[model samples]
Structures are given as structure tokens and as C-alpha cells.
Target: MSFATPLPGPDGDPLVVDCDSCVVRSPGACGDCVVSVLLGPPQDVVALDDAERSALGALADSGLVPPLRLMTLDDPPTHRDAS
Candidate 1:
């Protein structure tokens, strides 16, 4: 069984996996794991525009994407001005 939608990774990149040549084949560590098969590994960061973000938000609202666990930091990292 394969995943319909791609799993989200760090920095908005989608994780992809080729189950055919996967190391964790049947009877392995991830033998009966769905999440492990679907979510392979974080590849690259996807830069999302406003429209894309809106579409993703809609998909999340409709329960297409799995629920995520978010962590909030007391002091978030500050970005330097590029001026």
C-alpha cells in the first residue's frame, strides 16, 4: 500500500520513497510499517508561495495530511535584516 499524498518534512520539503529498492523490505525492521514506507527521508526545502500555503492549509483542514506535533520555543530565533 502506498500513500496518496506526500509527507511533509522539515522546511516544507516533501519526503519521497521508492519502495522497490527500499532497504527495509518485508520482514525487516520496518516490515509492517506504513509511515516508514511512505515517509522516506527529508530531501530538500520547498519554498512555498502564498497560494501554495493556502492550498496546503485547505488540504490540512480536510484531513488529507497527518496531524503534526509542533514545538514552541520561549525565544524564537531572530532573522537578520538584509538591508
Candidate 2:
């Protein structure tokens, strides 16, 4: 599957899920991820807003659903001159 790019969400909140960048992306992890649980299977990208994220967090906290297991890559390192 292709990596997910951030999308514009409600209130200008950017996308929260980038499965391709996730560090724990796997069949087992996907099954427990909120994206997979709610959206079903994996997709190229999954966009979620602040409200949606909060709601999902609540559900996960209440044990109603699994939390989002998205561990994306860290920020890229800055370049420096060796000379």
C-alpha cells in the first residue's frame, strides 16, 4: 500500500493517520488500530479531525475500541555543512 499524506481536517487540523509512516504497522497492530477497526482494513490515507480524534480517544479509553497505534517517523534531520 502507498504511504498516506496529511489531509486537511475540520478546524484546520491536519490528518492524524499515516499508516505508511507508522512504526508499528502490521497485521496484528492494524487489527487493533482505530483506523482499521473503524474504517476497516488499510487504505492509502486516513484523515481525522479534532472532534473525531477526541471521540475515538474516548472510545478507546472506555475500552469500546482500540486506540490509534500510529507511530510515525521522526522529523527529518537538518542538513549541515561538513566543510
Candidate 3:
């Protein structure tokens, strides 16, 4: 099964998965991702590419933190269609 995309890091660079939070399994945040709550004080934020970052911030400032939802799949019943 597939999952959500991975988060980015400050400097727009991807961090190494040094710990458990580094993985892309979690939808919220991760240590490796640039913008996430996983990091403690002095941790970096997830800085997306220039254009994307601007849009992301604008959306947040516009009182639309999560304007819309991305792809979401409804897990099928077990022992059903695997074809």
C-alpha cells in the first residue's frame, strides 16, 4: 500500500533519516522533514521550494491552514479484491 508524501527541511534540503521520525510513514511530521513538530527547540522547519513555500505560507496566512485534502484511499476489506 502507498502513503502520504514526505516532508522537507529548512534550507530546502532533505534531512537524513537518523531516527524513527525520519521515515515518511507519518503524515504529520518527522525529524528529517524540514517543516515538522517532531523537532524540539532549535530544530528546523520544513522549507519547501520557493514557489511552493510561498503558496503554503500564503494559504496559512489567509486563514486556510489546510485549505483542502490531498489523495486519500479507503482501505478495502480484507480477503476482497486483490486482482
lDDT of 2 at 72: 51
Cα lDDT tens digits for candidate 3, 1-83:
11122223455553323323322324443322223322332233232364665555465446544321121133233312211
Estimated TM-score per prediction? 0.33, 0.70, 0.26
Best to worst by TM-score, what's the order? 2, 1, 3
Q: In TM-score terms, which candidate is top?
A: 2
Candidate 3 local lDDT, residue 20: 33
Quote model 2's TM-score: 0.70
Candidate lDDT scores, in order, read 0.34, 0.60, 0.33
Residue clash pairs of candidate 2:
none
Candidate 1 regions with alpha-carbon error over 4 angstroms: 1-40, 67-83
Ten-residue stretch with the least lDDT total in model 2: 74-83
- In angstroms, give how far residue 8 of model 2 lies from its true place: 15
What is the C-alpha lDDT profile of model 1 across 1-83, one tens digit per residue? 12223323344443333333333334443433333333543233224444554455555557665322111132122311111
- Candidate 3 residue-pair clash tally: 6
Candidate 2 Cα RMSD (Å)? 9.5
Tens digits of per-residue lDDT for model 2 on 1-83? Answer: 11122222346575557788877678887887778888898667877766666677677767788766676545322211111
Regions of candidate 3 where Cα sits further than 4 Å from its true position: 1-47, 66-83
Q: Which structure is stronger by lDDT: 2 or 3?
A: 2
Question: What is the descending lDDT order?
Answer: 2, 1, 3
